[model samples]
Target: MPQANVDFSLKETAPNIGGGRVSGSEKLTSSFDLVEQMHFFYVRVVRVRDLPRTRNPFVEVNIGNYKGTTKYFKMDHDPEWNQVFAFAKERIQAVTVEVTVRSKETINDEVVGKLAFDIADVPTRVPPDSPLAPQWYSLEDESGRKGGRGELMLAMWMGTQADEVFPDAWHSDAATVSGESIANTRSKVYISPRLWYLRVNIIQAQDLVPISRNRNPQVYVQAMLGNMVLRSRFSPDKNINPTWNEDLMFLVAEPFDDPLILSVVDKLGNNKEHSLGMCTIHLSKVEKRLLPIPVCANWYNLEKVAQDNQNNMEVKFASRLHLRVCLDGGYHVLDESIYYSSDFRATSKLLWPPTIGVLELGILNATGLLPMKSKDGRGTTDAYCVAKYGPKWVRTRTIVDSFAPKWNEQYTWEVYDPYTVITIGVFDNCHLQEGSDAGGSKDPRIGKVRIRLSTLNADRIYTHSYPLIVLQPNGVKKMGEIQLAVRFTCSSTWNLFQSYTHPLFPQMHYLLPLSVYQVESLRHQATQTLSLRLSRAEPPLRREVVEYMLDVGSNIWSLRRGRANLERLLATCNLLVEAWKWFDHICKWKNPISTMVVHFVYMIFVLFPNLILPLVFLMCIVYGASQYRKRPRHPAHMDTKLSLIDSAHSDELDEEFDTFPTSKNGEVLKKRYDRLRSIAGRMMTIIGDLATQAERLNSMLSWRDPRATPMFLAFCILASIGFYFIPWRLFALGVGFFAMRHPKFRISIPSLPQNFFRRLPARTESMI
Candidate 1:
C-alpha cells in the first residue's frame, strides 16, 4: 500500500480590535467568526436510498438553535426531497451541521440514522463555478460509527446571492415564521382565470296567462344565474302581455358550463308567488358582444309547469318571452376598486393591452410610530410594509421591537396603464414568536397610502412622508408616518398615449355589461386567489395583512365614510352655488359699471352668435392664466376632513371598526340601530328633496296640478309659434338683455317660473 500523505494548511492570525496580543487558538477562532459574517453557508438535502424497513421516513437538519425537517415519505425505501437550507454564518453557534434521518411512523419520531459534517470541513463555492456535486455518505449513529444500512446524497457549500437556488432557498431570516408556515415562505406563481360578463336583458313577454284575472296579476321577471338571483321591477301594464325593458347582468368565468334560468312570476297578496312560465338559456350558446351596439332580442318559448299527481296529470299553457343574452368581453372585470386596484388587464388574454411604463417604489423607513402593543408593561412595535401593484406584491422584512425601523427595500412593476394605482400599507407584525417581546396576535394597521401612477411625472421621483391616521372607536389616532420614494418611468410617450385611445375595458363588456354587484363579487374572488398565491412566496404576507392593505372591508358600513362622501358632494355643489351667488351679485348691479359692461358683452355675443364660442373660450384661457400662481406647489397629502377622521362621533367611529356579522350585544346594537335610523332619516330627506325638484319639472306636463299643466302647455305652444318665425339670435338677445337689465328695473321678489314650479304637487306630501 502507498504511504499515507498528510497535508496541513497555515492558519492566519487575526489581530484584536483593540490591537492587544492574543493566543493562537483565539486568533483562529476570531478569523472564523470574521469569515462567517461575510459569507453564507448552506446544505442541499438531495436524496436518500436503501433504507432498511423504515416507515414514514424523513430527514431533519439540526444547526445550533435552528431545526428544519423534510416532507415524509411512506412505504418507500428511497425518497428524494431536493430541498435547500441556508444559514447566516454569523448567527450559527455550532461548529458542526448535523443531518438526521428518522421514522415518523413511530410516536417518538424514532431516529433511523444520522450524519455530521464539521463546519470547517464544508467547502466554499461561488457562482460561475459549477454547483457542488453531491456524494453518498454512509449512515452512522450519534457516535460517528456506521450503524444503519442506508446512504444519503447531499451537497454542502458556501455561496453568495448569485447561487442558482439563492432566491428560492429557505433562509434563517424567515425561520422565525415557524416550520408550520414553511409553505408561505417559498416562491410561487398564481394565474387568474379569464372571466367575462354575461348580460341577460329581459324584454317584454307575450301571451302570458295569469293565475287570477280579477287581481290584475302583477308580473316580474326573476333571473337565476349560479347562486345569484335578481328580480326586475313589476310590469306596469299587468295585462296578458307585459312589457319589462329591464336588463340583468352577471360575472362568468371561462369554460362556461352554467345555465341561466329565467322565471316569470306573478306577485299575489299574503307574500305568495305564482310562476307563469320558465325558460333555460345556455351561456355557451349566448352571443358575444364587444362593442356598445345593441344586442338583438330573440323570443324564447317558455315551458309551462306540468303538475303530476297519483290520480291525474295536468299540462299548463305555453308562453313566449323576449330576451337578449350575450357574453360581454369588452369590459375589464374589476376584482378590486379602481382607486387602488393594481391589475387592469382585460378579462380575456386576447384583449389585454400593452405595457406603458415601469413603476418603482422604495420603502425607505418610518418614524414617530406609537407602540402597537405592550410587552412587560412597556410599549413596543414590530413593523413591516406590504406593497401591491398589478399582479406582483412585495413584503418587507419585519423590523422587531422597533419604533423607527428602516427597510430601504425597492421593488419594481411593469405598468400597463397610467390611470392605475398602487397601494402601500404599513402594519405591525405581532405573529413572530422567536425573540418576540411585544405580545399580540392581531397585526394592527399603522396606516395606508395610495398613489396613482398618472399623478406621477415621468422620470421624476416623489419622496414624501405620509401620515398614518387610524380611526379607532374612541377617536382618530395618529399611528405614525412612513417615508416613501416613488417613480414612474415611461418606456415610450407614444405608447402611453396610445393606451389612452384604446377601450377602457375589452369590447365584450360594452356588448354585455355586468352589473355593479357582480363586478364587486368577482373582485372578491380575484382577491382570494391573489391572497392564496401571495401566501406561497418567501416570507408570506399573512391573510390579515393582505386584507387590511387591500381594504377588503372598506365598503363596510361606516358613518364616517358616509359623512365624508356627503361632504364631497356638498363641496362640489358649493362651487356651483358660489358661482350662482357671484352671478346674482353681478345681476344685482352692486357695481353698476361692471354690470353695464356685462350687459354690453352679453348683447354683443347675442347679436354676433358666431363669436359667442370664441369669447367663452377666451374667458376660460384668461381665467386659467390668472390662476397659474395659485396652482398647487406640493403634492396633495391625506386630509383629516377628507377622510372624516377629525371630529367623528365616538359611536360612528365604533361602528366603523365593528366586526362583520356584528359581535356587539343586543343593547349596543339597538343603540347603533337608532343612530343609524337618525342618519338615514337625514339622507332620506335629502333624497326626497332632490326627487321633489325633479318631479316638479315633470309635473309641468304630468297634469298633477290642476292649474300648472294647462298654463305650461299654453306657454309652450305660444313659445313654439314665436320660435318658428323669430331667429335664434333674436331669442338669445331678448333673454340676455332682459336678464342683465339694471337693478332699478329688476324686481326683488322670486321669479314666476320658480314660484309656479315650487307650488306644483309632489308625491312626498302624500307619503306617511
Candidate 2:
C-alpha cells in the first residue's frame, strides 16, 4: 500500500521550548541536534530544620522561568523532602537558582528563609564518580544576612545525563505539572512479564451417565482460562461416550495462580445448558514443554455437585475426562501486529536476544489541535503524549489549556530489531480531574503515529510534522498535527545487517509453524494477557486503548479493507499491462524514427550479446538516480482515504462488525451467505485461471495431453540442434532483424508461439 508522504520539516535546529528562542544563524544541520545537549543541574533538598512554628511549611525551587514546589508539611518544624529538582543548562537564562522556604499559614504567605546558588559556583560532577554530598545552608533574611529561621540541607551539582539519578529526577521541562502528580510525568522503564502459551487438549470422555434418560443430550467440552473461553463442537452421537479431539490455548504468565477449568456441558431444550461434570487443573501441576513434543494424555475423575437442605454441596462420582495440558515456552508470543512487533524474545528467559541499537525520540510539540471535548462552557484540551517502544512506555506531563503544547522530552530504548516500530499517541487527559478518576474514564485520543525503524537512515535525525488521523464510525478524520524528531543509532552495523540473513522469527517458527487458526487464537490470547498486565501498571492502559493499539479486531472481515487490498493488487497488475502496451506501440512503429532507433539498438545488443548485462545494469542505475529527486522525506502512516466511504451494502457492514461466530439472525446470515457466494464466484474464476495456466505448463512435460507434449518436444529438439550448429549471436541477430522488418512486410496477426500456447490443453475440462 502506498502512503501519502510530506516533507514538513523542522527549522534546522532543535526547538527551544523552554525560556529562550533559537536564532536561525545558530541552527545546525549536523548529525547531532546541538541544542539537545544538556548540562543537567540538580538541586537535591534533603531536609529542613529550625523552621518557624507555622502550618504548611514548603520549599519552592525556581530556575529561570520554571518553578517547582515541595509537598507541604502541616505544623511540622522540620520537614524532610528528599526531593531533587533538575534544570536544562542551555535553557536556564537566569544567573542564579533560588530556593525559598515559605510558610502557607500566614495570610500573606510569608517567606521563612531563602538561598541562592550562582551558576558559576555550581560544581560539575561527572557520572561514575561519588555523588556530591549535601551541605547545610544558613537561612538568610531580606538584607542577605544569616538568620535563625531555618537551615536547609541541599546538594547542588551539574552532571551529564549518564548520572544514575537522571531517570528519576524531576526536570524543569515538565514544570507545568502539579508537584503532587510530577512522578506520573517522568520517564520510567517497564519490562513485560514472561509469558508462556498454555495448551489444553481434550481427547475423549467415557462412561458418562445421563441424569435424565428421557431428555436427549448434546454433549461438548468447554475450557476456561481467566475470562477467555473456548468450546468444542457438540458430539453428533447422543451417547454416554463421546470424543472431541480439540485444543484450546491461552497465554499465561508467571506465579501460575490461575487454574484452568474444564467441564462437560450438555445442551437441553429451550436454549438451556447443564454442566454434567467438572474438573480443575492447577497450572503449576501442568507439564511444561518447550518443544512441540507429544504429551501422553491422562484421565481426571470428574465430580458431580449435589446440594443438601443446609446448602452445603457434596461431591459425587461422575465420568472421567481424558486431557493433555502443557506450558509451551518456545514461541515468541505476538501480542502486536506481526509487521510492527517490538520484541522478538521467546517465553523462556534464556532465549532472549541481544540488544541491537539505541532508538531515541524527541517529542518536539503539536500544532493545529482542537479540543477533544467541551469544558466549562468553552472548548479546551489538556494534551499529553504517550510513546511506547519495546517494553518501555513513557508518558509526558499534560500541557493544559493549549492548542500547541511543547514537551522537549527525549526517551531511548534498546532496539533489538530494526524492523520494530515506535508508536506515539496524543490524548486528552481525562484522569487529571477527580470526577473522571472516580468514574475511571479513559483519556480521549487525539491521534497516533507509528514509525518503523527500517524506513529510517541510521545516525540521522528525521524531523517532520505528521498529521494525526483518526478513524471514526463515520469516516477517517484528521485530528491535528504533531512534530517529532527521531534518530536510530545502530550499536553495530555488522550485527544489524547480519540480522537480515538470519530468520525473521525464531528458527522453530520455520521448523514447525503454527496453524492459521492457532495463530489467530494465540494472538488473541496474547493481546488479552498484555492488556491485563499493562492495566495493572502504575498509570494503567485501558482495555480499549490496548485493543486499538494492537489492532485486535482488524482480522474480522471488512469490505472496505477487502476493496483496498483488491485495489492494491490491481495496481500491481497494471504495471505489466502498461509495459505490454508500450512494447506493442513500439513494434507497431507508431513513431517510425524512434522505432528505427530502437531496432538499431536491439540489433547491436543481439549481435554482441555480451553487452546485454551491462546495458540492463546501466539502465537500472539511471532509473535509481532519476528517482532520487522524488524521494519522500518523512515516512507516513495512516493515509486517510474517506471515499464514504466504501460503497458496500448495509448487510456487508453489519457482517463486517459481527463477532467471530456471528451474532446475527438466520435471515441476515442467509443474505450474508449469498453475498459471500457472489464474491467468491469471481474469486474462484481468478484462481481457476491461474490453475489452468500452471496445469498447461505441466501438461507439456507430464504427457497429460499427448498432442501438446509432442509439439513441445519437436520445438525443443529443433531449437537445440540449431543452437548447437549456428552461433547464438547470429541466430538472435536474425530474429531481431525479422521482428524489426518494415511495417509493409510485417503481418498484422498474433505470433505463432502465442497462438500455439493458447491452444495448449488444460485441466479446466475436469472441473465440475
Judging by TM-score against the true structure, name the best candidate.
2
> What's the TM-score of each model vs. the native?
0.63, 0.72
Q: Per-residue lDDT of 173-236 in model 2, one digit per residue for the tens?
A: 6676664455545545555666788888888888887768876678999888788788888977
Candidate 2: clashing pairs of residues: none
| RMSD (Å) per prediction | 17.2, 12.2
Q: Rate the local accuracy (lDDT) of all candidates.
A: 0.67, 0.69
Q: What lDDT tens digits, residue by residue, belong to model 1 across residues 101-186?
A: 99988889988889988998888896678989998989986667784659999999987544667646776756656654444344
- Among these predictions, the greatest lDDT belongs to 2
